[model samples]
Target chain A: MKHLLSASDLTRDDAVSLLDTAAELASVTDRAVKKLPTLRGRTVANLFFEDSTRTRLSFEAAAKRLSADVITFTAKGSSVSKGETLKDTALTLEAMGAQVIVLRHHASGAAQRLAQSGWIEASVINAGDGTHEHPTQALLDAYTLRQHLREGAGDLEGLSVVIVGDILHSRVARSNVALLTTLGARVTLVAPPTLVPVGVQTWPCEVSFDLDEALVGADAVMMLRVQTERMTAAYFPSVHEYSRRYGLDSARAARMPDHAVVLHPGPMNRGMEITAEVADGPRALIVDQVANGVSVRMAVLYHVLSSQEGAP
Target chain B: MSGLANEPAVDRAGEREIVLRDIRLMGDRQAVDIRFADGRIAAIGATAVAEADPQAQILDVAGRIGLPGLVDLHTHLREPGREDAETIETGCQAAALGGYTAVHAMANTQPVADTAGVVEQVWRRGREVGLCDVIPVGAVTIGLSGERLAELAAMAESAARVRVFSDDGICVSDPLLMRRALEYVKAFDGVIAQHAQEPRLTVEAQMNEGALSGELGLTGWPAVAEEAIIARDVLLAEHVRSRLHVCHLSTRGSVEVVRWAKARGIDVTAEVTPHHLMLTEELARSYDPLYKVNPPLRTVDDVHAVREGLADGTIDIVATDHAPHAHEDKDCEWGAGAFGMLGLQTAIGVVAATMVEPGHLTWADVAQRMSVVPARIGRVEGQGRPLAVGEPANMVIIDPDAPWLVSADQMASRSQNTPFVEHTLPASVWATFLRGRPTVLSGALV
Candidate 1:
């Protein structure tokens, strides 16, 4: 969980190893047992201050499928609904004796606080926090991409993955940029200037506002959901304006390399960020990202809870 | 006669002796008698033509300008959902001090003002708070999901009587969706206020897509993302024969598109934010999250174009997209923070420094854009009225030459998210009136 705070927390070796484990877990999902005993007799709690159905459920299912008891705490109705401080909730959850806590929060550095707060002895997993990162989501996305792209357990040494859309407000984009770069994959972020965050010059990736050029020769394309709510605050103006220039309708989707696939974190603004034709298209790995979410999380829970002696 | 709930409380004992010696009214600067009565302008005329009662509350403003109270078509109070950041009362107080008589409350709230019930709740809260008239903008979509249209007729029929339906922070981006929205609102004599951004092109966008975005290593939100949407929506409005108000029109391309749309006789109106008209991408050089806005600040050319658009009436209003943010939402590194800035209190001053002072817009033009046009777009019956008898008497007195420095400490909004901190700007507001009652006196909220 402490490692879930920032992408800088993980060394290249640790990230690569996690990817490898995800591959192994991916293979295991095809087996008849489907269930893993990795975290047996333990309890994992999902503490999500943010409302993300797919991510929250994936971690929930991952913990349950691993034979570990799962406790779900969403910010919507739980003590968080009382506006009870996250600190108090953390203390309460800690008292309940949770072994691992997968947390998603709206504020950046929230998970980092829970990990470093010394409130509990549980392992931590970052589902996502603000526009900071979602290591597990990035891992699962990469895992899904690698299955179709990298063959025979080969490394993604020289491949390319282009993340397109609202990178400024996206925790998922941040995670994908760092993790993909760490694995030696060429990362390209394509977005409007208003969509990109400040101080991105030092990151290891090529930045392009032009989607047509960014998708050329790309091995994978990750489409982000353009939050309309963020725009009325004058982030950007009008959805028709956003869609006409940036919408990943079928025409733009066809511009990618034939082998390239489309990815989104879900809750898609269909016909706006992406056309229904493409989100439902054959090359779309959105559902795959959701599926791999479980496997990657299962691996994360197992590694963080069991491999305490050689912890990264 | 309404109560003093929306008026600035005049402190009886602390009165001072001063006079507005030379009142600059548009082109001609002349000596005039400006008296305050019941927290309103009881008389205004050439010095020889009018007399001030000795007992009347007198303030010396020898070399200052008095413009009508400013109005904002766009401002997010963040109440009922994120009041930890700002409230209607505090937000309106900030607006009053900034010389605003009315502000349109955006619909992107917790339960979202997509229905009459929610708009009434928000409207009642704003009225009960007694700061300024908060005109609730109905949500364009049901949950702002953009798939279904909201109850335009219902919202229009509500107590707030909302005439503007917008998914402001969220775009009604779908074409068939936008066309239908434009058509739906037209039946009720409403305008569909568009945020004008392409979602797919700008997904995860941070700042303007350019050398700066490359230098900052942040994701680029291309100018085209905004321009493309404006171009299409303007044409869409023309096709549907419905009126469209483009909110916060930034970028030169967007301005040109709006101009072309106007030339083609499309019933398209546009607005520019004080931040966009004044500041530029150079602030991004500081890496401060506060300066990092959505539609990221464009280049100087874009700034000049936005100013010109306003000057030539291509942009019809000057709205302050006042957004308040919690500290944690903006305190982190740019990549890890939310996108927004507080603009209410600093909006007029910023405009005075950037446009009014520079001659791009005279104070008369300022009154039109900031007062009259905004009221027209929002359909506030009594607000932005002519300066004559029998009106609601909403107005402001500006010490246009008053130099002031901006700091977060003076802000009334719950969150101190302004990017203009440390900015030294010309002009300060002396007082503001809502229905003949001063809500701000001597630059302080009553």
Candidate 2:
């Protein structure tokens, strides 16, 4: 309730309520005005230590649409590059009266440290952290899943969601597994054996090495972005081999049930994890995931700010 | 309040003889009085008070367990470089409070302790501090670069008489260099305490590689990184017929490898940190950098295996790899934060909690593991000796039943980065005597 740092922090009831709130907020985006007075006097600071233009703009749009003042601080040209620490940056923003901090850092536990450090008074919303949980991304992905599959009414009960590609380094996959499984969806992680994390058998989901075998009965398939850096790390021998084994092409898409949809937490590798045909196909909810991202972020910012009186 | 400058000397030429009353020696059912004079135990019997000089100071420590003063094989004082984190004086104070009479200061300081000059400077600083004997551990390679050999023989012959050499915080990973370092130290009977992490396997490693690290998303510090190096170094040590001491043996596989090496009659000794014996990788779930350490806290099974290893004499000693970092270093993100936590002040309590209280190790076994064996391994004289007549009066009195809450702000170390801040730990050290000099009295630094 104090912060939306991880998907695992959300319970069944909390996730359902947040999703329901996002559903209500989604209608506002369709309106001509698309403005809400709920966070009119509040301030939301988008603190991106890692460059993610799409995610930054999504959060900025969410805050602006809610009528809250938004300020963006990227690590690229700011004091962060000049040897300023995350604590100092966060404190500076809080001093300037930022009530909520949406952080995206390259370090895994940066957001958690900020929240628990007792350094600042702002409520922390983890936009995304290094290979760690992206709670908002998970929420938006869950929102996207509910809209196409369940008509946006209830939890994803009995929904078989199979997540594909680099589960080891994907914050999206980690967050989605936590949130989707929490929402009663049966999740399966499919990756090349090298791409899969060690000690993943303890996760609440099933695992598969074969993309085809995992795709057959899935209700929703989420493709994670496989970075070029992972290739050099020798996680896979080559792009050709990785794509051949785990990439979702037209043939792999045809293996899934007709009702099943594909989702990607983009910026995607067009030819690597997925093909152009499947990404832009009718069953692909990739664009919808982006649009729903703003709604979910608004619900999060509103929830964090409106429910509390002062510093958490 | 200064760790050294402002303190009055506890040991002086005119110091009076002292009589410790009602103290129970290790494995002893009945308590006895121990009288000290001229930096040696004068008597240890029922009639010690009658035999003592009339000017002797009589102190009552009823029912307290008395043992040879603890000696740490590995410690990071952070002095001669980063005094903002810790100095020899404060580190020794913390050591005295933790019941350690002597500590082998690790060689990872800035301007790294690789030469005779640096090691002598560190050794001299410990002498000036006059708290605990700070035996400087010489670096195996020049500046710990893992390439060429350091001035190991010169450091050994220096005033520090450094017998334990290490490239701690950076492994001497090159096998040829490792073999050469291991073989070269044999001349001075020196032991190489290797920081057993394979550098490549732990490039960006943040925590122990397992289910927890997979869940936390911090890069995995796989157990193989530690085990592989230990296995390699032990074989290399056996081949060269040199002594090899594994620093902070963390994983269960590492323990198995050490057991195998010992069974194979390899001249290999291993030491486990106090934090490793108790804390596990589960603490990484909080994402707090306080639990962050090198050879990252392993799983519960690894903990049990190390405990069993220590109990069975496979792990030779309990060393407090008490690495201290400044507040700025640990107050940030887990990955960006510095590795290591304060251990000098909490070693005994952690050992008691994880080993003794659980019935795995006896008080006699504790003396052997924490004090006797560590002194022998480091080749320290006048320490790890019996608390008997004609023996050097290096000893500690521990109240086994007294459990105290750990607070970072109260520690004598310059930095407050202890992971055990709020923990109520067992077995408090009431007093620590270094050669008849009281460095810690009534649980406070003297």
Candidate 3:
């Protein structure tokens, strides 16, 4: 609960509690003026050493909405450029009274280092680390589905979702497999051979390459955009060929059940992953995922930093 | 000479005052005086040269020897990105303290040395520091991505004028691709220095794959994983008739392969690092990440084989695969830690104490393995030299008998990642002279 380093450590109740807190936080954004004084006088720092505009901006906005002072620290234009070490940076941030740190770094286990180094007393939250997990994104996706599917609009008991893309380089797939399965939802990962990391057989989900089989009778289909830079020299035949097979075109999107919905974690390629019609269609929750990002991050920040010690 | 008024009295000394006392004279146990002036050997005699000038400096070397300046074929400066780990300036300072006059700066840095721009950046920095002559090793694969060949000809023509090419942190795994690279480098007489790990075999490998890896419960980095590639590359080198330099040769099995290639004259050279020569896999039982390295340390029996291999001329060079890492990068659980340890300042003594005093090697052989042979393998010019008149004064005055304990904080490299920090070793370097000027005096750099 202190640092969301990995999703596999979360229990069923822990996932539900975090999801429920995010729902309450999401409801505040619907008011005439979205603002809260819950985290007043506290300081939250978005210390992103890696590039993720979506995640960085979400935490920044979430901290500000709660009336907490937000400081966004990135690698560019910082003393990190001047050969200062990470522990030194964290100590400097701690000296400035940062209570929570949301960090993303390129090296694997970098987030764990910030938490364990004792350089900063701030509560840590992992935004995304190398080939590891992204906890908040999975929580938001779970919250986005529970609004319609959960019995009391709470826990997803019998829902089904499929995450399709580069599962090897994705922290998103790792986090979702843990959180979605914990909440009693069937999860399937669709990826090419090169796109899957080793030892997925032990993961708590059904991994398949046949997107057609996974698409049938799905309640919510989350299409993960392929990270192109990691492909470096062509992981597949071509982007064009990848889109022709696994992309959520009109024909594939129409194959889902009537109650099914679509989700993507934005910065989408227009004609590649999701076509223009499916992205703007009613079943798509693309925009809502962005909206939900702030709420889930706020809830995560509050849960870790706040003194609320009531439930699991 | 703005500071000419405050110059030292040694420069004022007349000709015959330059005396080389306590001379083993190429590892033969005897005393001799080799006179020199303006940085060259003037004479070799049984008696000391008289002080022809009153202001002449006296170098009283009682029980030591003389050899050529040391050369290292592999050293990671970690500049242009990870300066917290090390920089070329600091690494070169350490190299001088270790009695080296030249070292090859590897290409694995931020924005990698795949391009001519980064290679020049590193090469120019080494010159600006003026510690040692830095031979920039260009990347074989672009960005070290292992997909396509880099602009080798362009980098070879830059100010670095690179001749050694490698994807050193990783292997050029595909044999066909290795052949093409070997064939391509033939046009320019460039050597492909391979790191020699099979990618598929060492996916999660942590240490040397054997009883040690089994006991530690860490993934095994098999010895054959390195040997297999050496086997394939040696034959490939024979076919292409090009030079192939194997980086950080560990294990007795690899020693035999290099020995066979050398006997057959297949144009191959191999280097054993100081750590591999002095330490063994048994040190891994301590569970320190500082002791962790790629091409992991083998057994004591293997250590003897390496020493024997170096002596009998199977191994060509004694490179200090000096790598630096930050505290956070190394001070962690074994499996979660970084690979490599600091080597530059510790190498000479480790080589001397472990080999020189053991009668397995003399200072002459040490000079051959550490400096002369490395200079030939790396094709460095004007670095490793005999004490002759016309050679550039890239040399060192080593005590060769002063015992000293190494401390991590005493090192010039920015990172405290040395594995042999507390160990007391013999044969310390007292001073080093590069280009007729003192760079290191009394074992400290000026």
How do the predictions measure up, each by TM-score?
A: 0.60, 0.96, 0.59
TM-score of 3: 0.59
TM-score of chain A of each: 0.94, 0.98, 0.94
Model 1 C-alpha lDDT per residue in residues B338-403, reported as the tens digit of each score: 777888898878878888888888888888888888888877766776664334557677777778
Ranking of predictions according to lDDT: 2, 3, 1
- lDDT by candidate, in order shown: 0.78, 0.90, 0.79
Per-residue lDDT tens digits for candidate 3, residues B1-446, read: 31211122345334333555665655667766655555444455643365323544556666466677788889998997899999888899998998888889888888799998988888888878877778889999998888899999888878777889988889999888899899998887789999989888887777786654543334568788899999899999999888899988898899999999989999999888888998888777555667889888888887988888988888888888898998887865455678887888888889887788888887878888888878777667676777665555556666776889889888989998888888998878876765545578778888
In model 3, the Cα lDDT at residue A34 comes to 91
DockQ, all models = 0.05, 0.82, 0.03
After superposing candidate 2, which stretches have Cα over 4 Å from the reference?
A310-312, B1-13
Model 1 spans > 4 angstroms off: A1-312, B1-22, B35-42, B46-55
**Of 1 and 2, which scores higher on lDDT?**
2
State in Å the error of residue A210, model 1.
Answer: 20
lDDT tens digits, residue span A1-312, model 1: 334555656677777777787778777779888887766778888888778888888888888778888888998878888877666676677778776778887755567656765556666788886666788888887788777888625456888998888887788888888787877799999888877766677678989988888888998888888776776866567888778777788998888889888989888989888999999998999888888888888878877877554432
Error of 2 at B238 (Å): 1.2
Candidate 2 TM-score versus the reference: 0.96
